[model samples]
Target: MFLTQTVPRQREIIEVLFRNGWGYMRKLLTGGKPEDPQLPTPAVLKKIFIDLGPVYIKLGQLLSTRPDILSSAYIEELSTLQDEVPPVDWSEVEVLIRKQLKRPLEETCKYLNPVPVA
Candidate 1:
């Protein structure tokens, strides 16, 4: 993850891990009752994935396919993983495309939609 992510995103991931640890600690300290309602089991996993972002969602998908490695219940929950990304503004996509291709998007494609393919 550190290899693939920019510095700020790596920091964000570590912060999420700390948040999860604190969540568990709060549960333990209060004997399972908390100010906020406790998350359901699947909700906790989903929260973790949503915080971590797309790469982790892809990792969860890969893990979900390994029935021998995970119990049926866990596999079932993980199979629900989605990237949960909002659509990027086309301007950002154009920037990314230009950076990768080292040319303007118009130069590379005869036709390009401002909206992403989804």
Candidate 2:
């Protein structure tokens, strides 16, 4: 009785492993190789999300917020990725600020605070 249940579980695990291995082999055979020859690791899906630009990043962040919709592991990984993006340069920010304020940096505020207080 117990053997019947265990056998199906074992077979399921084996099938999953086989499919994954075969898929990886297919990628290798098709020249879907990594750029780094010495450290040829599979392309990380998280890195893909990061590379896809702000839209995907925002989707991941929103998915992280929806715990009910996402799996626990997915939520955790996406949460970790929430703000892992590269910051825009200060120069760009300064330019935007000047444009919005319609004034030079010196005229914006008498006592300009570079960093905002919490």
Q: Pick the candidate with the highest TM-score.
A: 1
Which residue runs does candidate 1 get wrong by more than 4 Å? 1-6, 19-41, 82-92, 113-118
Q: Per-residue lDDT of 1-118 in model 2, one digit per residue for the tens?
A: 8998799766654454344444454455467873432311222434445554456677777877888986676777777666566554567678888999998988767765555332
* Cα lDDT computed for each candidate against the true fold: 0.68, 0.59
TM-score of each: 0.55, 0.41
What TM-score does structure 2 among the candidates reach? 0.41
Which candidate number maximizes lDDT? 1
Positional deviation of 9 in candidate 2, in angstroms?
49
Compared with the true structure, the alpha-carbon lDDT of candidate 2 equals 0.59
Report the Cα lDDT for residue 9, model 1: 79
Instruction: Mark the regions of model 2 whose C-alpha exceeds 4 Å error after superposition.
Output: 1-60, 111-118
